[model samples]
Target: MKKLAKACLLITAVLFAAPKVHAQISIGVTISANVAPPALPVYVQPACPTDGYLWVPGYWAYDNDSEDYYWVPGVWVAPPTPGYLWTPAYWGYAGGVYGFHAGYWGRHVGFYGGINYGYGYGGVGFGGGAWSGNTFRYNTAVVNVNTTVVHNTYVDKTVIVNNNVTVNNHNSFNGPGGVTAQPRPEEMAAMKEQHVPATSQQQSHERTASQDKSQFASVNHGKPNNAAMNKVGGSHFTPNGQKAPRNNNNNANNNAANNGHQNNDAAKQPNVQQDGHANNNAMKTTDAEKQDQQPAQQQQHVQQQQHNQQQQHVQQQQHNQQQQHSQQQHKQPQQQHKSAPKPHTEQKHEK
Candidate 1:
C-alpha cells in the first residue's frame, strides 16, 4: 500500500510539471534573460502572390542567454484546411517580465495580446473572413488571391485595405504606457480548446537562414526553420527565466580583431605627435642655420611665442587626460612631456 501511494504521487508530480494542454494547445515555459532590445527591420513581401496562403506578421523575440533580441519576419502560410483560423502570436507581462505566447489554430480568431499582424489582423481581433458551408472568402486586402491556389474562395480587393496596403506604426505596435487589450470570450474559448500545433512546413518556413544569422541579434533559440528549438546550452525552459552563458566565440573573435586595430591606432598617436614635434624643431634649426648664427630680433620673438604656444597646448592636453583618468581605477600614465619656456631673466641675458 505504501509503494502504490508513492508511485501515484510521483506520476501526479510529473503530470503537473508537463506543459498545459488545452485540446491541442500546448504551452511551455521558456527560460530567457533580460536582453537588450533589437531594432525592427523592414519586412517586405515578394511582389508576386502565392495562392491558398495566409500572412503572419513579423516580431522581435528576446533570447535570454545571448542577452539580445532577434526579429522574426512575417510570412505567408497556408491554413490548416479550408475552415481553420490563424491566431497571431503575442507576449504578455507576467511576474514583472514578458512571456511570449505563440499563435495557434482554433475555431475562431483568438486574442493574441492585441498584436496587429498586419492586413486585417489589427489589435482588436481578426478582420479576415470566416468559413460558411463549403466556401472560405478571405478579406482580399489582407490575403493574396491567386485564383490558381484558391478557386472556390474569391476576394474583392476593392473592399480590402485599398491597394493591398498594410500599416505599421507606434500607434499600432503599443509600447510603454500604451493601450492595454485582452482577448474576448470567443477568443478565450478557442485558447482553451485543444490546439493543433503549427505545421512542420509552417515551422520550417519561419527559420532564419544560417547566412542571415549575423543580421539578427544573437540569442534566439529557435531556428525558425530547420529546428523547432536550438538545443544548445541555456536554450531550455526554466522557471526563474535565467538564461545560460552565451556562445560568443564569433563575437569574441571580432572583438579581438577590433582591439588589435585600436591598439594599432594608439601606437600611431605618439608617432604623429612626435612627427609634429620634430617638424617644429627642424623649422627652428633651419631658420637659425640660414641666419648664419645671427639672431634676427623679430624672428627670435616670433619663435619664442610659437614655442610658448606649443607648451601651453601640451599642458592643456595633459590636464584633459588627468581629468579623464581620475575617474578610472587603473590607467597608464602619459609619457610624453612638453618643452618649457625660458625664464625672462634667461632670455634677457641671452639677448
Candidate 2:
C-alpha cells in the first residue's frame, strides 16, 4: 500500500507541474478572465513615421488590480531582428472563460484568433507589408504611409479583394459571438517555429497605458483616447482622434515654432503682392481721371471761343446800324436843298 501511494503522489506532482513547464516554453504571456474584453476600437493607423518600423495593432489588456480592461495603443516598432513579423494578441473564449494570448514576433505571422485588427491584419495573415532583405516594404493599399518619408512601398488591392478582408466589425474575441476562424496549415507551422517575446519598448508602452485610467474600457467605453501612435513614445492620438503634438524634445518644439513662423511669412507674401497690385490699380485710376479732365478742359476752351465770336458779331452789327442812320440824315438834308431850288424856279416861271 505504501509503494502504490508513492507512485500516485509522483504522478500527481508531474501533472501539476506540466502547466508551468508549458508556460515557460510558450512565447507570450497567458491571461484568463471571466468576462470578455471590449470590442476593438475603430481608429485610423498613424502614418509610418520612419522606414523599417513594423505596425502593432491595438488591443485590450486586463488589469487584475482594477478588475477592468485597459487598452494598449497600437504603435510602430522595430523588430528584434530582421525578417520577422508580428502576430498580434487576441482573446479566445473556451470553457466558459475568455483567455488572453499575448503577441509575439516570428518569421511569419501566426493565427491571432481571426480578430481583424485593421491596417493589414485581415484576420488571417499580415498583408499590410513585408520585408525584402532587411528593408521592410509597406503596402499602401491597406497601410497608411507618408510617401515622402517612407520610400519602400507597393500597392496590392487584390489581397483585400481575394480575402474579402472585413475591417468594419469590431469583434474583440474568438468563440461563440466573435470571429469564427480556424488556423490554416501555414499558421500552425508558424506557431511551432521559434518566437521572440515583445520588446522592452512594447512592454513599457503597455505598462504606461495600464496606469492611465482613461484608457480603461469601463471609463472610455471601448474607445481609448490614444488609439494608435506613430512610434513608441512618439506622437499619439488625442480625445478628438487627432494626433497630439510631440512634447518629447524641446528642439522639436522649437523647430515646429520656427516652421510656423516660416509659414506665416510665406502666407504674408501673397498679401504684400496683393497690396502692390492694389497700388498699381490706384495709379491707373488716377491716370484715367487725368484723361477725363483733358476732354473737359478742351470743351471749356471751345465754349469760351464761341462766346467771344458772338460778342464780336454783335459789335459789327451795331456799327453797321449807326452808319445807316447817318446816311439817312444826310439824304434828308439833300431833299431840303432840292425843294428850295424848285421853289425859286416856280417864282421865275410866275414872273
Candidate 3:
C-alpha cells in the first residue's frame, strides 16, 4: 500500500514539475504514465569489436500504444567526429511526465540521470575513457576492450564527481522517490559546447530492436536474450519474420563439400577419364562455353598466321641474298680469264 502511494506521488510530481527548455523538448509526448518504467535488466556487455567505436549501453524505450518498454541492445558505434564522447539518453521523471533526454556526442560527457550504466558510466560521469585528438584512449580498468585490436589504451582509477545527483537508488525517473540529480557545473558547460546527435548506425540499431518482439519488457519480463551486439544491424530478420544470420559459413561449407564429392564421382566415370578422347571427340564443351572461347581461338589463329608470314618473308630475303652472291662470283671469274687471255695472245702475235 505504501509503494502504491509512493508511485502515485511520483506520478503527481511528474505532473507538476515545471518545464525547462534546458530539459529535452518535444512536440507530442506519450510514454509517461502513473507507473514507473521497468527496472534495468542485467546483461553482459559484448567485448569491443574494434577501436574508434564507443559503446552505447542498451536502454528501455517506450511505445505508447502498447505501453510496452522495448530493450535496445547495446552496440559499439563510431562517433561522428574525432575526440567526441557519447552521453547516453535516459528517462527522467519530470512535469508528471517521464520525459526522455536524447543522447548526444560532445567534447565532454553530460549528465545522463545518474543511472549507473556500468563500464565507466558509473552514474556520475564517464570513466570508461577519454580522447586525444582523433585518437581515443580507452580506460582498461572499466571497458571491455580488445587490446590486440585497439592499442592506444590506458588504465586509470581516478574518478571526478561532476554531478551532485542523489545516489543509492534504482529509480528510473527524476520525480518524487526517483533520481533528483540536477546537472552539475561541468555537465552544464559540456552541454553548451558543440554537440552532435547519435550516428546513423545507432539509430538503425534502436529501430531494429524496437521491431523485435522478444526485446519488449512485457515479453522478456526484464531480461532480453540478446543483450548486446558486436556491431549495429548485426541482427537481421528475414522476409518471413524469422531472425537468422545473414551469412551462414556452415551452410557455405556444406555446399562446397557437396560440390567436391560430385567432382570426385565425375572423375571416376569412363568418359571423363578418357576426357571424351576415346572416340576422338572427347572433351566436348557446352554450347555456351564453346561460344565464349570462339573469339579467343580466332585471336590465337590470327597470331599464328602472322608469325608464319614473318618467317616466310625472312626466308625469301635470305634466298635472294644467296642468288646475288653467286652471280657476283661468276662475273668475277669471267673478268679474270678475259684479262689473262688478252695478255698471252698479244705477246704471241708480236713474236
Candidate 4:
C-alpha cells in the first residue's frame, strides 16, 4: 500500500512539474498515414451577461489505440470564478516530446506555448484579450456562428482572426509527432486553480469505428518515409509531360505541388534535350530491332534504303557547304595566278 501511494505521488509530481507534457499524443510521422482526429463534440455555454466570460475554441485530440487524432472545436466558456481568465488549450514540447494540456479559466492569462488556435489564437498569446470591464468586444472576424448563439453583445462578421491559419497536417517529428513548446512560470501557477474539463457538448462524440473512415486512408499516400503508404500518395504526373519533383525534405512534402512547378520550369529544358537525344538513339536502335524481326531480303532492302537516305542527306549537307564556301570565295578579291609566269615566258611567244 505504501509503495502504491509513493508511485501515485511520483506520478502526480511529474504531472505538476511539467504541465506542457499533456499536449502531445502518439502520432505517426507520415502525413497520409495520420488518422483524422475525431471531431470534438460541440457544447453551448449558458449565457453569462456579467461581462467576463470568454469563448474557447475546439480542437482535435489524438487517440492511441485506433491511431488517430480527434478534432475538438472551441466553445463559449465562463470564467473560473470571477476575475480569472480562460487560457486556451495548446500543444507544447518538453524534452523533445510534445504534450497537450487543456486550457482553463485563470486569474490572469499566461503564456500558451505559442499555439495558434484557429480563429485568432496566434501562436504566442491569445488574440482575445481580457475583459476591460463588463464589456468584452469580440474580434468580429475570428468568431463565427448563428447570430442566435451570441445575443447579449455585438457580432461583426467582418472581424475575422483565423485568416493566417495553417492546417498543420504534416505529422512530422517536431511539429506533430511530439510537442515542442513549454509553458512559462505564470502558466504553471494557473494550472493549480480550479478549471472545467470540456463540457458534455464540448466533448466530441466521434467514434473511431462508426464515423466515416475514408479520410484517414488518404493522409499517408505518396508520403516519403512510410514505404507502405508510398503507394497511396503515388507519383502524380503533371499535365504536358511533367513529373513531380523528388525532394527528401519535410517542407517540400507540404508544398510539393508548388515546388513541382518550379522544378518543372527548370526541367523543361532538360526534358527537351533528353527527348532529342532519346529520339536520335531510338531511331538508331529501331533499325536493328526491326532488322532482327524481318526476312533477310526485306532486311537487306530496308538497310539499302536507309543507307541511300543517309548518303543523300550527307550529299545534301556537302552541297550546302560548297554553296556557302563558294559564296565566301566570291566575296574575296580575284587573283591573276598566271600573269607573272606568263610575262617571263612570253618574251618568245609574244614575238
Candidate 5:
C-alpha cells in the first residue's frame, strides 16, 4: 500500500509538471534582461511581395552575447501553412525583469502585449488583411498593395477610425509603465489553439539582423537604418520609407565628390569677380589723376607765353631809343655848319 501511494504521488507530480514544461516550450522564453526594450520604430510597411504573404511588424529582440536589443525588421512572408497568421513577438515585464516572448503562427491572431505595432496591428488584432478561402485579401486603407500585381485587395478605413485601436503610443513592453493591457476573450481563446513555431526563413532573417550592428538599439538609438524589407532577403528600406540602395557606400562617395566639385566652382567664381572689380577700380583711379593734372598743365603753359611777350616788348623799346638819338645828332651837326658859313658870306655882301 505504501509503494502504491508513492507511485500515485509521483504520477500526479509528473502530470502537473508536463503542461508547464509544454507551455514554456511553446512560448520559447530564452532570456530576461534587467532593462526594457526600446520603443517600436515607426516605418512604412513594404508592399506585399506576392499573393498570400502577410506583414510581420518589426520588434526589438534582445541579444545575450552583446547585451543589447536589435530590431528585427518588418517583412512580408508566406505562412508556414494556409490559414496561419503571425502573432508578433513582444517584450513583457515580470518579476522586475523584462522577458522576451517569441512569436508563432496560428489560425487566429493571439495576444501581442498591445504594443501598437501599427500598419494594421492596431494593438488589438490584425486589421491589415484576411484569409478569404485560400487567397489572402488586403485592406488597402491599412496596408500597401500594388493593385497591378496583387488583384485581391479592398479598401476599409472603418477599422482604423471606429475601432479603439491604440496606435499613438509606441510603448515596447507590457506591464507597469508600458502597455497595461489584459488579453481579450478572443485572444485568450486563440492562445489555446495549436501553434506552429517560426519558419526557417523567419529564423534566418532574425539571425541576419542580429549580426548587423546598425540594427542594434544601442547603436541606432531606436531608429534603424534598414527598417523593413519586401521579403526575407529582398529589398531593404529606410525608416523614412525609402528603398535602401545596394551600393550605399559608393553612392555616398559619389555625392561627396559632386559636392566638392560644386564648392570649388563656387569658390572660384567669387575670386574672379573680385579680380575684375579691382581692375576696374585701378582704371578709375588713373582717369581721376589725369583729370586733376590737366588744369595745372594749362596754367604753366600760359605763364611761359606771357614771359616771352614781355621780353619782345623790351627789345623793341631799346631799338627805338637808339634810332632817335642818331637822328638828333645828325640834325645838330647840320645847324652848326650852316651858321658858320652864313657869317662869312654876309660880311662880303655888306661891303
Candidate 6:
C-alpha cells in the first residue's frame, strides 16, 4: 500500500509539471519579475522586403538565466495567415512586481498594455494596414514599403488611435510611471477571439536575440547596433550590412568548396529551453499538506481570471454574430445582382 501511494504521487507530480496547452488561444499564468524592463529602444523601421509581410516592433524581452533584459530586433514577417495581426507583448506592474504579458496573433489587434510600439502599432488598433481578401495593404504614412514591389497601398496619414493612452512617451510597461492603460472593450474582444501562436521563424528570431550580447541594454544602453533586420533568418541582413553572395552552381569545384560552409547563424538557433531547475529531494507529507493549505488563494485568483476570459469570449461571440449578420444583409443583394449565368428552370408549370 505504501509503495502504491508513492508511485501515484510521483505520477501526479509529473503530470502537474508539464505545461498546459490549449487548441485555440493560449491563456497561461503571467510571468512576474522584480525589476522593471528597460525603456523601448529607438530604431528605424526596415522596408518591407516583400509583399504580404507584417512588421513586428522591437521590444525588451527578459532572459531567465541572465536575469537581464535583451532587445529582440524587429523584423518584417509573414503572419500565420493573411488576416492575422501581430500583438506585441508588454510588461505591466501588479502585486508590487511587473508581469510579462505574452502576445498572440488574433483576428483584431488586442490591447498590448497600451505601449505605443510605433510603426502603425500606436497603442491601439493596427494602423500598419488592413487585409483585402488574401492580400495585405500597406499604410505608406507609417509603414515603409517598396512601392514598386507593393502596389496595394495608400497614403493614410491620419491613423486611428486611442485618446486615453499617451502617444510616444516611450514607457515600456503599463503601471506606475509606465503607461497606465487598461484593455478597452474592443481589445477585450480580441483577447477572447481565436488566436495563433508565434511562428517558428519568430521564435527563432527571439532565440537568436537572446544569444546576442550587443542587443542587451546593459551593453548598448538602449540603442542596439543591429536594431532591425529585413528577414528573420537566412542572412546577416541588417539594414546597413555588407551583403555576401553565395555561389550555388553545380560545378564540382563550387560544390566542394561550399559543402562544409553554414549560412545564416540565426537559422541555427536552438529551441528556447524550459527554465525549470529540478531538485532531487524526497517529498515530505507535511510539506504537501502545507501546499494544499495555500491553494485557496491561488485557486481564487485563477478562477477570477478565468471568469473574466469566459465573459469576454461570450461578449465577443455575440458581437461577431451580429457583425456577420450585418455583413450578410449587405452582401445579399450584391451577390444576387452579380452578373452570372443563371441556372435553367423548366417552364412546365405554366403549360
TM-score of each: 0.47, 0.61, 0.58, 0.37, 0.62, 0.59
Best by TM-score, which number? 5
Order of all candidates by lDDT, from best down to worst?
A: 2, 5, 6, 3, 1, 4
Which of the two candidates, 4 or 6, achieves a greater TM-score against the reference? 6
Model with the higher lDDT, candidate 1 or 6: 6
Tens digit per residue, CA lDDT, model 5, 244-337? 8643332223222322211222322434563567766777899999999899989989998899999999988899999999999989978877
Query: Which residue pairs in candidate 2 have backbone atoms (N, alpha carbon, C) closer than 3 angstroms, thus clashing?
Result: none
- Cα-based lDDT at residue 285, candidate 4: 92
Over 65-144, each residue of candidate 4 has an lDDT whose tens digit, in order, gives 34444332233544445455656654433333334555555566555555555444544445444454554555434443
Candidate 5 regions with alpha-carbon error over 4 angstroms:
1-28, 161-166, 246-351
True lDDT of residue 338, candidate 5: 79
lDDT of 1 by residue, 1-351 (tens): 543553354344334432322211224223222222333333333221444456565555543323345455455566777677777665543322344456677677766665544466666556655577546666655544555555545454543332434544322222233335655677667677766667666565433322234323542342222111122111321212233233344333332232221122222243456356776777788987978756576678989999999999999999999988885634433323445677665434554
Global Cα lDDT for candidate 2: 0.75
Predicted structure 1: clash tally = 9
Clashing pairs in 1: 22-194, 23-194, 24-194, 24-195, 25-195, 33-64, 206-224, 207-224, 207-225
**Can you list the residue pairs that collide in candidate 3?**
14-95, 14-96, 15-95, 15-96, 93-174, 276-282, 277-282
TM-score of 6: 0.59
User: Which stretches of candidate 2 lie above 4 Å from their native place?
Assistant: 1-29, 161-166, 238-241, 245-351
**Residue lDDT tens for model 6, 146-250:** 888888998787874543111476699877798867777898788888988789999988877766665566666776667677778643333343342322221
lDDT of 3 by residue, 218-336 (tens): 66787666667767866533222235454333232222232321232233354665334643344344566798899999999999999999999999999999999999999998887
Reference-based lDDT, residue 245, model 5:
68
Assess each prediction's global lDDT (C-alpha) against the native.
Answer: 0.47, 0.75, 0.66, 0.42, 0.74, 0.69
Better of 1 and 5 by lDDT: 5
Tens-place lDDT per residue, model 2, 95-178, is: 445667789999999988888887799888899889899999998888888889899999998668345433658899977798
lDDT score of residue 266 within candidate 3: 33
